[model samples]
Target chain A: MPTTPAPGTVAPAVHLLAGALRRALLEEGGGFRLARVLPGREDSCAGLAAVRVLGADALAPFVVKGLALPAQDAALIRAAVRAHPAPQEPERQVLLWGIRDAALVRGLAVSGVDATGWEGLAPAGSTAHLLRLPWVAMAAELVRVAGAAPPFAEEAVHAQLARSHLDISRGLVRALLRRDLPSAACLTRWLAPAGEQLTTPALDYLEIAGADDPRVSLDTAIARRLTTGTSP
Target chain B: MTRANTPISPQGDHDDAADRSRNVETETDAAAARLAHQVGERALAWLECMRGSFALTAETPDDHVEGQALKSLAELALAAGMVRREAIAGPQCADTAGRLLDFGWRQVGRGDLLYRLQARTPAATYPMEIYAPFAAAGYRHERMDRLAAHLLGLRASRVIEHVPNRRLAVVAAAATIGVTVPDDVAAMIGQTWLGGTPEPWMLDAGNAYGVTHTVFHLTDWGGRPEGLPQRLQDYLHQWLPVWAEVFCETRLWDLLLEMLIVGTCLQRPLFFPAVWERVAAAQRADGMMPNGLTTPPADPHAAWRNHHHPTIVAVVAGTLTLSRAISHATTAGGEA
Candidate 1:
């Protein structure tokens, strides 16, 4: 079953599979069962896209459900890696390498993954990357699989977050008002590591800024869980 | 005073836009102070040119202060008094401010209309709010102050209902006229939205107005930053930039300047180039900043109706920024 209710009316394959993964994550004590897709080349492509969109987060729900990876779901990670190549840009490579690293770092029951893949993607801890998108998703996956908080501990990252707190907060508010619900939710999740209560009031705005999309719930759920130290 | 033949288009993504934004972000204290003074003066000049258009109509039975032109002139009185009180921006502003103050006082028959209005509704604070600026400038009327003193003592006056920020405005006006009863001020400040120090990012347009007015009242038309407590001061220091960005991007020129005024209300003010550059770019060669992204009307009356408040906001905001910038520089220089 989809974790956060169906998006309804022929949702895209990436979202459908992502929603299933997110649902499995929030289960807390439930078993992991990968959602079944139609048998076609398109289905295989969609699965890899979902795996990329989630990066490490694609496998996080299985870990949360406390299930050892079946070879079939493990094959999804292997296929995603084979399908996607590392990029030259530091941020893009960090994002690309994150999928393989998550599977390895969490020591999932996946096979044929390169142990040295993370070394090829150097500067994996860029400060600017920590401020942008996909970082939050990757971060949420890390938190779920490894019981780690966001790694905003470096001094440069700390200073950057402090200096740009207003900018980040402004982005979230603008997204909420613009009704770009997914971006707003991602920003909400991204701001979870702030020492002060950066968005206690803004959390309510997310409820009112509701979207029909399940990714909104997934991002918001991760944010609330991170901040409150509770299950979604 | 060379006005462009056509309006300077608002900045686009050209290299100059980046340069201008960077210039504002990196200016020295002397540079920032000069810009603030110039911005304030151009806005006041625009207001002075439109002075004749603030025509009053006879009071209708409903007699809402906001529904009458009297409110506009009264607001002009506050802006003029601020320019004169700060008294350091420039002589041109000072001269224009003196003339404008005389014009506003004359428009109200030199406090006679104010006295009559207060007499009719002893509990109505509007006339007294108008009268306070005149009194503060040594233009006090014996009869008006006596009536205001009586009004200030009344239980009805103390209990006159207003939204919390409006209540703070009334209290501020009473302080200017030297007639506020003490506890009313405390209770009023406690009830204001800003006083609560709630999450400022959630502020929409309405709540923003409430917060801006609360700052205007607390700082006493930008005359006294000391009036704002340290807690509220901290709240504004952390939050005003986001509000400024929110308004500037949405093209709410009035609220954007209102936030700029709040910027100056902090105990320690700094030049915010990113927000200020957008505002400077938005102003026309004639000094009119449109209230929104909508093209300003060609008709004078329509333009005035649409833009007068943002113009007034520009005046006060620029002046306060100028005044506070000077204060901040002088203080820093002394410390050095």
Candidate 2:
């Protein structure tokens, strides 16, 4: 899920920038500019922070369109990569590895400059249904690049997804019942990509529920695309 | 672009996980039986202590004995009769059932009130509904039965439209009273909210209760499993656990208890020991059920007024699930 400004503080510029990048990815002709994406002298830290939060999705349109990665955009990613330490938390760690790997595939980071292999970090196990929900971020990142960066197609994750379809569906039901839309939307987006083939009544609920929160709107938009195979 | 080629997790595994969910293994059955009995016993101990709450007197400590208490008393008598008939709850529970039932019968004025009510409103269903449990316990009033038979003959009684589960209750309640005049139960079942087996993900608290009570009437409060259709049984097996988890999170303790009781009556006897433990834990030391009240209301009369139904529900859930657990064990032993 894209970040929401934490309540009670002024929403950071990076949060708005990340949302702009997400908006570009979703809206047709929303214009992807190399200059805007490159780390700049002012608020460049915030710019890279925005990309870090949005993860690989920040690079999606460039990667998908086969456009050359600008040298400055590469530097922007490198700066973001250098600034943040690898997280100790499992979900954050998964996010860290996914962002690094997305850069590697797109030629933004050379070997040894940034760590790449995300497979070892993919959440896999009996507790996946409960613990791995955050893995939706991994899927969300991967969805932006579609076929170019294959996170779900990786062997271990695919096997886990096979076993977890029911678990995923069950989690989706609970999330909806609890009125936890962000979770519900995340689970909905991840369902079919994780190999679950079923009607997502939860997505249908989100569509009609009229939630105006931008984060939920983005997640639900992506969810609608994933489940229905419509344009994002 | 690493074009994706790894096959999606096979449809075979998905179906297999579903298959596993439906089958009840022998060991699980034995453990569940023990657990179900424990939950019911603790709940019954509490209800017996608070048996005065199941009163029909015009007034109690603070409030009038109205619809809620009246319904609670009938359900108490119903649960007591079921336990006494099943005799699976052991001597102490059965003895508690016996005393509480005597208390319940006295509350109804030993059927005089029921007879008078039926006479007053021959078109009404509550009098027959309340009287059936008493008759099942051999507390007969010949006049009441005659009144019910006459009511059953009326073209009006047969056609009164109740929402599907209520319709099933009326039909099942008739059977409990030993009247053979039957309505089209299968037709009624077809009309229930659950009969069509609507979308499981859309289930809300109100519809959830509708689903639970429909199952209750189908199984005669868990006395018969064959009465549940294979289609509906399979439907519940697949979805009931998820529904139970949702309700538990919502803290609908009584609804969760009802769903657990429904689980015991399935042809395969679905068991979730964790859920049973949580539900049993929710019962207070003195046998008062929190029902769904997270905190007791400040007014004493309001607290007593709101208290009666879920506690009675606990008794039925306990009796029905414990009885099912025993039968499941018997069947398992026979197979072994």
Which residue segments of model 2 deviate by more than 4 Å?
A1-4, A7-18, A21-41, A59-79, A88-156, A193-200, A208-211, A230-232, B1-35, B58-65, B180-187, B297-304, B329-336
lDDT of the structure predicted as candidate 1: 0.65
Once model 1 is optimally superposed onto the true structure by TM-score, how far is the C-alpha of residue B291 displaced, in angstroms? 1.3
TM-score of each candidate structure, all chains considered together: 0.81, 0.77
Q: For each candidate, what is the lDDT?
A: 0.65, 0.63
Clashing pairs in 1: A3-A23
Q: Which candidate wins on lDDT?
A: 1
| Cα error of candidate 1 at position B111, Å | 0.6
The residue-by-residue lDDT of candidate 1 on B91-201, one tens digit each, is 888999899899888878788888888898887788888787787776787899888888888778667778899888777777888875754565676787788777665
Ten-residue stretch with the least lDDT total in model 2 chain A:
A121-130
Candidate 1 wrong stretches, greater than 4 Å: A1-11, A33-42, A62-71, A88-115, A118-125, A128-171, A193-201, A204-208, A230-232, B1-32, B57-67
